[model samples]
Target: MAGPSSFAARRKVKGVQLTIMVVGQSGTGRTTFVNTLCEQPLIQHQQPVAPEEAHLESGIRINPVQVELEEDGVRVSLTVVDTPGFGDQIDNEFTFNEIMGYLERQYDDILAEESRIKRNPRFRDNRVHALLYFITPTGHALRELDIELMRRLAPRVNVIPVIGKADSLTPSELHDFKRRVMEDIEYYSIPIYNFPYDAEEDDEDTIQENSELRALMPFAIVGSEEEVEVNGQPVRARRYPWGIVEVDNPQHSDFQRLRTALLQTHLHDVKEITHDFLYETFRSEKLSRSLVGDSMGAGYGAGQDASVNPEDLATQSVRIKEEQLKREEDKLRELELRTQRELAERRQELLAKEELLRSLEARLADAQHSNSSTPLPPSQPQSPIPQQGQPHPVLTPHGGAPTNGLQ
Candidate 1:
């Protein structure tokens, strides 16, 4: 049995590419995990987010990073995408609505772009290669919202369910977690993995932990029967060189494994795609040849002859560009006018505040001066009597010796 790092060294493959996505509720360490994989601190939010701040890119935004990993003559291309935690304790509804809206807009945008490409002669067929979904483990089973989201996205993409934060669970607890997760995902037929199962630890510890998981999750499966244990309640998990592993963070260990696996698996598994699929695949070199030589002969040449005219395409493109430029100009003019009006209003507000402050200060000063100038009435002097005291009385200004108590 090999450790996670050693498995990385042993795995041999070439030129594999994969796109991975990390998702969860707000503040579930998604960003931190991505930064670890990228080997750099990416982005983090300091406060609870509203819908407006969801797209702000400072905190609640999607971050994409790419890296290449080579081990034992095997090369893999990994693209890790970090998305904002959809629902937060403080702003659950707002975040959910915003994210849902964004995804809807995103799908629409993709479809629109695909339509544009299909309409053009130059690009007829292109699409994204693979899609990986990441989620942190929770005590409860997959939520209704999770299932809904997965159902919506599964057909359109190759959904890989990654059980992130496996380190948080103990051996037995982890077993239960993986068991429940697989059972829930059975209906969707989504491939699931208990990833990041403490990759930094020794092989013995990880294998032991994995075995416990296998025992509890008997019906759950991996890529192959040989790679996983379905019987004997194997309390010690067998090592798979290609299975996902835990690293210090998602971007480094599990992230690397995902990248390496995709680069290998996609190159091997993907063969032919339909015209509809091509519109999304982005027309990479590996897939370009697969588009031609169809039975119906509905290809680049046929589409070009039937629906496209080169001069018209060029004219339409130029017209679109001109319209885009005009829109940009209009937006800039509107922004400038708004800015000037805001500045004028701010200046007036500031002047009013200053005048109010000055008036208050003057009133305060006047009150203080009047208080200081006003004099208090003098008190009456007391007479010193020799009979009442031991000392003799002193004389006063107006016969005070006789009148002031000389008796």
Candidate 2:
């Protein structure tokens, strides 16, 4: 037990808030243990199911009950979460998922609360501080149900194993049973809550206290709500024809030690472990999973259901280059068409020039032919008159000359 020195630190505005979840198969005395711990009827007992309702499947349910506890002059706002029908089903794999999902959902709430732009003032962190897992005392070792349940739940919550209905075994049988259960836990490497301490960092008293508590792992618990008067004092106990089992008796059960640990001595440590290590591990795994999915979705947009493919930067670049190439090809074709038209016009001008030159040559040839035909008018000679002094001469182109003046 911690003295005055331990109470100096650790609390919230409304004192320490601790949420504990109890999970086990039915008939494990879960309801009676809660009532015994709280000293009140915090949970109602399960009634016998009728024939019609028994046939129908009742799934595992998570229900929480609130209570205020004053332990060692400290106010604790405690929430007791009860999980019923955990191992009663024919197929219990789904029940494991149901419990695990509830735990993670509480963590998810805190995660969302952290990411909010405007945080909720009254947001409650329902994350479970510790989980008291009740194992049926079979006078042997841990069954598959016990092993599987604790192994799966150890990571998310602080799993503390307790032997339910511990009074069923004799003292020697109970010791052997606890030994076997601890052995199974070790064999399977289940991370049940054992009081942890640092040898070098923690003081000697702290280390001794924690070691003493750790030695009592898998607490043997017997709970009862009925009171029996012993020595004029009413003590909570369970009655049997053989003898009466006192709930708080150290020789009979470990209820008192477990209660003190939970409510007073180690409450702060349990809450710290849950928040610092367990919940942080879950948060890291969840964020890593989401990041992986988001990375895959970046290139393809909204994953499998996306109707439109997101445009990639490389694809856009390729399309732009193709458009430029098409424009350049169009310009080249237009220039080619212009050059062909100019060449055709030049050919037409050359043909027209050749036609005009041929027409002039034909007209010249016709004048020459007309003059040749008219030259036959013949032998008529022209008389020449001499000039200047006073001589006149006439010339004829015949065998004899003929004078024009005489003609």
lDDT of 2: 0.85
**Candidate 1 segments exceeding 4 Å error:** 1-17, 42-60, 66-78, 89-131, 188-259, 263-407
Q: Write the per-residue lDDT of candidate 2 for residues 218-309, one digit (tens) a residue.
A: 89999998899978999999889998999999889899999999998899899899888997777655554454446567663434424323
Candidate 1: tens digits of C-alpha lDDT, residues 1-407: 78998897666654555445655655445555555544455545446669876765343555556777553465656566556645444444454454444444444554566436245454322223343444456755777656655565554444555555554445566567666777788876654432224556648765674554344332221111122233443221224465433342232224444534345433333312212343233222112322332322655454443344546545544555576689779979999999999999999999999999999999999999999999999998986445855656555666654343555
TM-score of each candidate? 0.39, 0.69
Superposed Cα RMSD, model 2: 28.4
Query: In TM-score terms, which candidate is top?
Result: 2
